[model samples]
Target: MPMDRRSVLKGASGIAAASTLSGCLGFLGGGGGGGNQGDAMLWHAMTESETETFEESLSIYNDENDAEIVAEENGDLRNNVETTLPTGDGPEMYRWAQDWAGNHYQRDFLYDASDDIDFNLEDTFSQAAVQAITVGADDAVVGLPVGGETVTLLYNKDMVDSPPETYAEMESTMEEYHDPSNGQYGLSHPIDAYFVSAWMHAFGGYYFQVNEDGEGVTGLDLDETKRGMEFVRDSIWPYVPADTNPGPQQAIFQNGSAPFAVNGPWSIATFEDNGINVGVTSFPTVDGNTPSPYTGTSMWYFTTRMADDEDRRESALDYAKWISQSEERQRAYADAHSDVPVLNSISAEDLGDQVAGFKGSYEGGIAMPNHPKMGSVWTPTEDAMNAVLQDDADIDSRFDEAAETVRSNWEE
Candidate 1:
């Protein structure tokens, strides 16, 4: 975690050289041998336009460094990376979320790129970005940070003159705008743990703690977490629909039936395409505390298989450093994907207003626990939230039950 929310929304951008690779990296094709010279493969899950952006970015790197880089999109990316790495047959590099770093590192499948990459983290990227890739007690750098995202308050500017500054104000907006009978709502968000984490942090709660040993200690703050749950059950539930998921929540807001929503930047393009005059900002303060959404990052992970081949590892690290450290490339990516860059060199003036707010949300946000134990949290939390919304039990008791479920899963 970096500074409290106030500091993070402040700024961050990368560079593409003007060259192209001679050959293509097979899309979803089988992994190939280590690079004989400057050639290497990068496997990722990006689609359509995203794939084009990635290829273009790498092409810049390839042109600048005389590297032959093959970039490919794999629908089965995660499964392939997990199953193939141990056999020393995975791509030299792969793209994955920051949270996946811990599980993959634990499996002894990831390469430590601390000594390989050329940039100084403190000077180049946000503290959160640096922390996202660092692993173990030694704090080795496991990945090179790229695109980042966090949930924020997305509101219709046409419906309200400005975004709400506090939860109380937001509630007042809900009171004024929520007309269920008229198919309109002031606010609507998915009722999953992913979205609810913002509320949890607003109430000063968290999922787990990581020790100096890089080990996780389950630290689900029961009391504060329950307070968060109570707010959702007693307060927000009344204004929202009986049931809501991502699609319906986005639909409600995009169709003008909802004036506000909590969503990630990924939805911004869709909202714009539908002609919604959307405005974004950090989630309003709750109980005088900043709302902390779960920060997510897309990063480049070097594999043990790549590290085994000295030439390939060197080429991979060079490319990763170029993509991550180049300020111009980072800015280009931000423009192409509507993503917020993690590099500090990009400057605040470059990101514009709405993106700065999302960056601010990331600043005030908490990193999702990378530990495998986090796998146990989502289902139990979702079940508890659903039960409370359906009036299945008292809020406190339901939350207590959910905490127990999380602990049980961790123990198992």
Candidate 2:
């Protein structure tokens, strides 16, 4: 089975538990600072390798600049931030997905550092990265984008001579290799909204779009969305396993039973570790239209607590800029975590072939909306998809219900 994000986080949390116990003992023995009081604290839930690389970079920063920045690993990071940040008692800075920027800023938990940050946004990061962290009426820059990730076409080089360039060719390959009795498949990908977004985008459908009044509106009921759903049901569903979970889908590809899979960089190491010769490429075109997956950036966000203290805020900004802007640090992230470096100076070639292959997909991808309403779209969309694909429910009606549910959820 593929080691997905949840499994990785669970493992990291165990390691963090041991480290936290050690810190607690030290604090009790007089070698201590009590709980984010005197020094700047950075809360993150990075994987083990990523945490190691970040700690190395941070140690250098601390030694060279006389800064007292402490990194803390949190198991339930998002929930902890939402709960503690409003009380103004959390860390000065936290690392999270860029999609949370608008929600956090709207709740008065974020610090807008647009004017205070030293570097220019346009000149520093990719356009998608910049857009992901920009929010609100005045277009406040809420966070510093450090890395990006997106789904792409991953295939087994031993099975496929060359990846298909068009949907028709891909469908033909699926037909040739699909054998349900033997547990073999041509293609494998989770049936979740995020994984299937590329298909919807190729059919000119979108999940949520900002309206004239800067409000997010759901596109679940759109005709294009129905068409996209129908295409997946009729064309792709027949070849894939009935189990829509990512584990089963990914196992098919990892075990060499499937030639191609749609996944992100997180799954790359597992595939290679399993001895499958993996190759990354952009999605096949659909009737001359390229499929666009949703792209997300992970960034360091400054909290309202930091903004209240001048010294802390300055230190936080300096650390954020140094870590985000340094090409060497960004390269370390790319090498260690398979993160797509957001720095404009770091090209895909500088990282490796995997990063290079994902470049086209990332370029053509859509930056995921950072609006708070985007949170309401996910469950309804996934539920509707499951109904239509698993239970053979009517796609149009299910999507209409989903659209209504999304609107109702957002209103609440």
TM-score of each: 0.88, 0.90
- Report lDDT (Cα) of residue 115, candidate 2: 88
TM-score of 1: 0.88
Q: Candidate 1 — which residues are off by over 4 angstroms? A: 1-38
lDDT values for all models = 0.70, 0.77
How many clashes in each structure?
9, 0
lDDT of candidate 1 vs native? 0.70
Model 2 bad stretches (over 4 Å): 1-34, 37-39
> Candidate 2 lDDT, tens digit per residue, 1-412?
1112233222221131233221100111111111565458788876555667879999999999988888787766766788888776888888876777877898899888888877788898998889888898788988787877778888899988888899888888888888979999978887777778888878888888888898899999999988888888887788888887766787788788988888777667677767889888899998898889888787888888877788888888889989889889877777765678888888777868777667668778988788877877887888899999889999989999999998998777
lDDT of 1 by residue, 32-62 (tens): 3333333777887664556777778887777
Clashing pairs in model 2, backbone N/Cα/C closer than 3 A:
none
